[model samples]
Target: MSSAFDDFELKGHKLDNRFVVAPMTRTSADSKGKPTELMGDYYARFAEGGWPLIISEGVYTDRQASQGYVNQPGITDAPQTDAWKQVVERVHKHGAKFIMQLMHAGAQFQHNEYTDTPIAPSEVKPKGEPLALYGESDGWKPPKAMDESDFDAVMQGFVGSVNRAEEAGFDGVELHAANGYLLNEFLSEHFNQRGDQWGGDIGHRLKFVAMVAKACKDAAKGENFIVGIRLGQITVTDPDYQWPEGEDAMIKIVKALKEAGIDYIHTTDTDVSRKPFKGGSNKTLAEIVQEFSDIPLIVNGGIDESNYEHIAAHYPNALLALGKKALANPDMPKRLKDGETIEDLEFAMLQPTATLENEWQWRDEHDKHIEAD
Candidate 1:
């Protein structure tokens, strides 16, 4: 029986084990998108607890407009880059690898910092405004249809950000192309309704994604800078949403990423067991996608001991990512290593908004409030 404790290697980076700490949004950064010191301690805790790779919460690439919420972190400038070094050092201190996840909210942005409208691949108005965090709500608005310059920024911003990440001492960078964000907007037919070269069919939809991949890959010039993308089976806009080109589209996308010299691909969904779209083989989505490349593959969402055991029994090559389970117990990986079991998931334990001062105890307090409801 294959277990989640097995070692794995990808692109010359040797992981301690298959436990991947999946990213989770914690509204704890300062106004300028620099992670607070407490955030560093938060991440280091995971490493201390024994996770192999810690993929951070989405960090915007642009200074002002790249945010989905007011408190999200950014890596576009010196202060932000300099600030992340502490996080990297802390994670590495505990013998775990760290990766920065670059994300652009596009039309889903819900902050008032920037005066210009958000940018997207098309002018299609987002169906619902992103819910406000705390009391902030003035930035909710539709996005501007991206022009050539916008696409250039999409490519260049990612390039610059990943370079910043590399400079900050992160082991790698993961592009957040999932969850109906800017990248997914371009990739989904339900969100993007443009007729230009950047949209329409699956090939065209992938153009921007491919451009970003090349830029990120190029920016990873020296060092074993790992560059990968996190994608999902369905768009966040709708549970039923899928690639416009059908299920096999990801196979093509994977080939393109491999050709671009990407190091890995990460996948997730509401449940990893969901059969998202019509595809070639009857294998699980992760199985079919992994068949496309020898690059390391990561599958996340609802992963616990039982899920990991089942998946490991079948797809022994896939890495398991733990999200809520990790949150419920930061020492989860270590516990499993010690021959313990995962605790029951407590969804109410997550804080809708977290701050450095409060994040440490937010779960306990919130669990009291939500569980009572």
Candidate 2:
């Protein structure tokens, strides 16, 4: 029987354990999208507490319009890279590997505040309104479709961001291909209706991601940096999201990434126990997807201490990513490893709208409002 703390190798780097601190956007960075001292402290806490692999929050590439939220970190500039280096150093000092998630918001952006237009594969409007980068309003306008030149520029931006991540001392990079970001928009038929090489069939739709992965691998020549891509069935717009084409699209995309030399596949599903299809009783989404491909898989979303043993036993090769649980209890992995009772796990710390300063405050207030009795 293998323990959660057992040593594991992923994408060429040896990890102290199979537990990874999945990427969660705290929005604690400085105004310039640079990591601050507070950010360093925040990440260092997790490393010291005992997370073997820490995937940083989704970071913008180079395109200004790609910035989806205010204060979200960016890896495109030198100062930003320098800021992230401090985070990497702190995580490494505590015996953990850090990976940066390179992302582009694409059609998710609302106004021209970041840029005149948010680029997308087609001129289709996003299903719902996403928050503006700077304000607290609701109505967001649709983005203009991208031309051939614009598409190439975005690809270059992704490539450039990966190079900067390497310079920042990250152990590897995870393309933010999962969430309803640029890559997800391209993958979905409802969003990407282009008639070019980047649209039409599944193969064409997967071109951009493949190009980005290849660029990252080529950029990190001798560094042996682990390159991975995060793919999922959910997007912000399509919350109850499912790939209508079933696993066929996923299989094709994974095959392309494998050919591009990507080392791992990070699959995100809101609930791991739920079957992917309606009536067909089959393996979970993560299991089914992993079966189709031959790369290491990191299963995230809906993981808790109670299910850690069961998950580890069932999916031996998959790494479990704890989001809200990890945020509430930074020592979760450590507690599990020590076989300590975890019934007091903080639940309110996972509030999506609460800030770091207000998270604990809100939790305290809520606790006071609700007595143990």
Candidate 3:
């Protein structure tokens, strides 16, 4: 069985180990959606701590309805792209590969600079309240159903973001199709009630995402640039919801993504071991991906040092992506390798908000040693 710490290669990029810093939302960018120097330091710390790959926070893809939070960073303009270049430099200085996660919040939006309204595949709203940790929106509002022009704009936003990521010196980009975002909304039956090519059945629902994947791949054609996606059945606010087609739907989704030239598939769930789909499938979602596709896989959810070895043994070739644990211990891989105690994440660190500045202040007050540059 392969160890989680074993060196691996994702696409053509050589990874130091199979541990990746999963994409996390840190609404700490400047009001103009430009990444700040603090954000650069925040990311570089993880790489210096020893994670091989880092998938960035959900970056807004367009100026329309994509801005999900008050200060969420975006990549629609040159200044934003230039700001990310500094972040990329910081990560590379620590010898880590960085992939920007492009996102368009569908209906889970709390605030947007350009528009007051949100947009989705259908006019539906998300099931639960806005995350208290992300923002202070009272409740979700009904969204405008995407039209033909909206579809074209969404496509261009993603394509343009990928091109900007390439120019900004990022290793690649991961389409944020998970966590109830625009692409995930398109995949979801709850949010996609359209009768057109963008929605209807499972096949139609997969069309837009597949098209986006192909467009991203086309934009990032050479230079060992990687294009991947994150997918899950559960939304941030609605965890109990399941796809109508269950395991069969997930299998079909994986097949479609592979055919669309997605270099990797990152699956997140409540746990890596749980069979989350309906109809009582024996296989976990990660297992289904391994069975259906030959590309690289990144598995997240409830992974820690205690069970990571076992999880690694199960998915021998897959990378182990961690969020909560990584937050508590940025040097998680090195800590595990050296038999050091890995810190557990206290909700206090992210209490007021999930921003970089808040985390730093919490660490200071709690005497948590943050490494200096």
Question: What are the lDDT scores of the predictions, listed in order?
Answer: 0.77, 0.76, 0.91
The Cα RMSD in angstroms, rounded to one decimal, for candidate 3 relative to the true structure is 0.9
User: Could you give candidate 3's per-residue lDDT for residues 1-373 as a string of tens digits?
Assistant: 7888788998778888899999999899999999999999899999999999999999999889888987899999999999999999999998999999999998888999999889899999999789889868878878999988888888999999999998999999999888888999988999999998888888999899999999999899566999999999889999887888889989989999889889899999888898998888898888998998896899999999899989888998699999999999998998998999998999899978898889999989989967735
TM-score per prediction, in order, is 0.91, 0.90, 0.98
Q: Order candidates by TM-score, high to low.
A: 3, 1, 2
Best by TM-score: 3
| Higher-lDDT candidate of 1 and 3 | 3
> How many clashes show up in model 1?
0
In candidate 2 the C-alpha lDDT for residue 123 amounts to: 80
Among all candidates shown, the one with the greatest lDDT: 3
Best to worst by lDDT, what's the order? 3, 1, 2
lDDT of 2 by residue, 1-373 (tens): 7667778888678888888888887666777888987678778878887888899988888746777776778887899999999888988898888999888888876432357677777887677656432334455556778887877778788888888888889988899887678888888887789888888888898898888888778877445788888887678666676666676777788789889988888878777676664345465667765677778888887888877777777777878888777776666778777887654445455345434544546656767221110
Instruction: After superposing candidate 2 on the true structure, give the runs of residues whose Cα lies further than 4 Å from its correct spot.
Output: 110-113, 131-135, 277-281, 341-354, 360-373
Colliding residue pairs in candidate 3: none
* Whole-model alpha-carbon lDDT for candidate 3: 0.91
